[model samples]
Target: MAGALLGALLLLELLGGGDGKNEELRLYHHLFDNYDPERRPVKEPEDTVTVTLKVTLTNLISLNEKEETLTTSVWIGVDWQDYRLNFSKDDFGGIETLRVPSELVWLPEIVLENNIDGQFGVAYDANVLVYEGGYLSWLPPAIYRSSCAVEVTYFPFDWQNCSLVFRSQTYNAGEVEFVFGVDEEGETISNIDIDTEAYTENGEWAIDFCPGLIHHHGGSADDPGGIDVVYTLIIRRKPLFYTINIIVPCVLISGLVLLAYFLPAQAGGQKCTVSINVLLAQTVFLFLIAQKTPETSLSVPMLGRYLIFVMVVATIIVVNCVIVLNLSLRTPTTHAASPRLRHVLLELLPRLLGSRAPPEPPRAASPPRRASSVGLLLRAEELILKKPRSELVFEGQRHRHGPWTAALCQSLGAAAPEVRCCVDAVNFVAESTRDQEASGEEVSDWVRMGKALDNVCFWAALVLFGVGSSLIFLGGYFNQVPELPYPPCM
Candidate 1:
């Protein structure tokens, strides 16, 4: 520190004398004043400059699937040899290095065209360190908000390819250009050491492959192309979270929809409510799926498509419940069973399904003596009503009212035959009641129709539920197998 202070005092004294004999200070002034501002850092007027770049990805900012935008931060070191910026060793007290304003020397005008406009991060050639041998290297770090087209055909289990395209703006192919360095002195660049170890792995995404290279593409009508540095980033979804939280729940809900069919038609109202809830659950999952994937309709996500399919099947189940309830509640007086329905559902379908109706309850036996007397009485009454008085009232009355009433009728008949007519009238009344009781034993057509409908629909629903869920869930399982390939399906 004392030696540097003494050297500063000596330089100040020389500058105070105004004779301009200070070698170090004068060398700095002379170099800056005498430098040609128009000259480039090249040996020949048209000699191209070759730039070598090394990069490191620091962090990921955001990836917008719907808008297809990716924002990240990176650090790049650019190296190039400059002849115009070199200085003689003997000029300034044998100084071997000099740090000066970067604008004082020529710098490459390479820019990343894929970067989003109006949101570029601050960057500048802040300080340029020039060595005595004309070696110029600049290390600048920037947060690049680049956007790329996103393909989300297999979302939640999907992988996307995005790129950072670097190009030149100020210098074109006509004047200054760029060339990519394949190796450092014929040694391959280490791509695996791109600062990935410290990367903050996103909760929803994982890096598949990050390969960067330089390639010169031909010019187009819009702009002349010279050189481009493309850093390809392939990222795939981390689907464990979605599979457990979203996909599994959705699948279980779909299974519930299939089970809704098992609820008896007697619970049709409850079954309809359950089916509606399944639809609502699917709707919620569908919304979540839309949030996870891009807006393109090129293809549907496996989970989203599955949810939609289950929703459709659930709607059909709702309709089936309505039909079952309607059939089960029909009344014989208002709605009789159609012949076609009876043949198809009651007879044909039951035989096809190998099903049988529930047995009716046992009935009490009629009194044998009463039944025989009634049968004889009915014959007498029927004969009396059709064939005048051919049958004797005393004979039929004895069976229906017993021998006491017959004897009373026979004694009364001696006075007047019309008086015995009372016994015949009682027989007629009993016969009418027998017919009404017989009709009550037969099952009503409406009840039989309803039971037939319930059995048929129950078996039919079983088949549909099995087939529908098997096909749909199996398709989803195979489609979402992450290890099938880089791009499994579109």
Candidate 2:
């Protein structure tokens, strides 16, 4: 670029006479000396002047989906005629172009109407090219932020159509009117030209075509008309990022919710804990999506709907957990199992479910103590037991009676206190044995209820989960397209 500029200066110097004066130098000096850049071609406010503008989109800075903003940098070119500065190439020694500052001409107050921030600054002062006749051209580079409508119906796999609109701010249609200049190839309308190699490909979005439109606002020929240029950019989002980060994990957590039914109530109530955890995890994911989306409630996001569906299933699983636990812990003593229910819960269900049946109600041995052991206790304890031992053969005889005779007399006196003590001990042990047997039966009922309740819930939850996930995701999958502008059949 430096070399090119140096060569152009050398050519200019050669064109001028070496004696420091020539017709070419005088003609160049006369053209600008009388020219006023501030003057427009016409003075009337109602008169219209058509200006040709060339815009080439250079960079797509960003397209913020959540914020609904489109940021871009572009190179713009404007062309007009300056009648006062007319000059001929024949007199100027074949000099075809004149380089001058941009202030040397009138500039139309053009602006991007849809700009989000409405900033009025552009890339600083650049040179304009003037023909040997009266033709003038100015080119500048600028960055603009424009507002766009976000449609999140098909989010993560959605398509967006955004526009960059350019219009004259000061001159509506009278003083100045804007038109898209011929493309470099001289077509009436310039194409949305972008340098594809330099474009930054977003990980989340794929760029589609950007098409330009020249729009004319309805007005009579006498009235000033409104004209603007719009470049519509159509892009589609990539779903892989959302799928890997959000969908897969959500599905896994939802599957975990299904596992709650299989988790036995005997698993220390972990089934309920797991269901609660899954519910909470889904809530967290939904919150994250809310922060990244618009606050309007017109429609629910696709993933949000899926999470909500999973949460409902998780809730049902939690409720089922409660019911199963209640049944499992029900005691026969507090709530007697109906005879019919006992057959169904303890007998029929286990067979139908192909599961381990609970052990039958317990029964204690009929006799509290062995007869042989009791006989030995009586014989042996008579000598050893201090309290039950008799000290007399007669009322006052302590050491005279033999052991056989002492046992015979004790039996003979049925109402004797020693005889009564032996009967009470045997009866006390028998009553304890009956209490234990009843306790065993109650425990057995609890075990039966647990197995039956588990079977019931496992099947119920499996059905609910299958239906919930299928209906929710499938509905979204089928109706993913946005129904706007027109119901797209494509």
* Highest lDDT against the true fold, candidate: 2
Candidate topping TM-score: 1
Residue 204 lDDT in model 1? Answer: 72
lDDT tens per residue, model 2, 105-181: 67786778888886755665677787867888888888988898887665555677888788876666667777777
Judge candidate 2 against the unseen true structure and give its global Cα lDDT, from 0 to 1.
0.70
User: What total of clashing residue pairs does each candidate reach?
Assistant: 0, 1
Candidate 1 structure lDDT: 0.66
Worst 10 residues of 1 by lDDT: 481-490
Task: State the C-alpha lDDT per candidate.
Answer: 0.66, 0.70
Runs in model 1 lying further than 4 Å from the true structure: 1-39, 85-104, 120-132, 174-187, 190-193, 219-225, 287-302, 338-340, 347-355, 360-402, 409-490
Write out the backbone clash pairs for model 1: none
lDDT of 1 by residue, 1-490 (tens): 3245336747686668443435444544545555654566666766777766666677766788877788777776667887655677676567666655555666676677887655443355456666776777776777777887876555566777788777666665545555444454885442312554766667776666666666766667655567777777777777799879987788778778656656655677898999899899889889988887887768877677667777877887789778877776665445656688778876786678787655767989966676756688668756766553413655566666889987776676766756546656777778878876544432344445555666666566667656765775566455432342233111
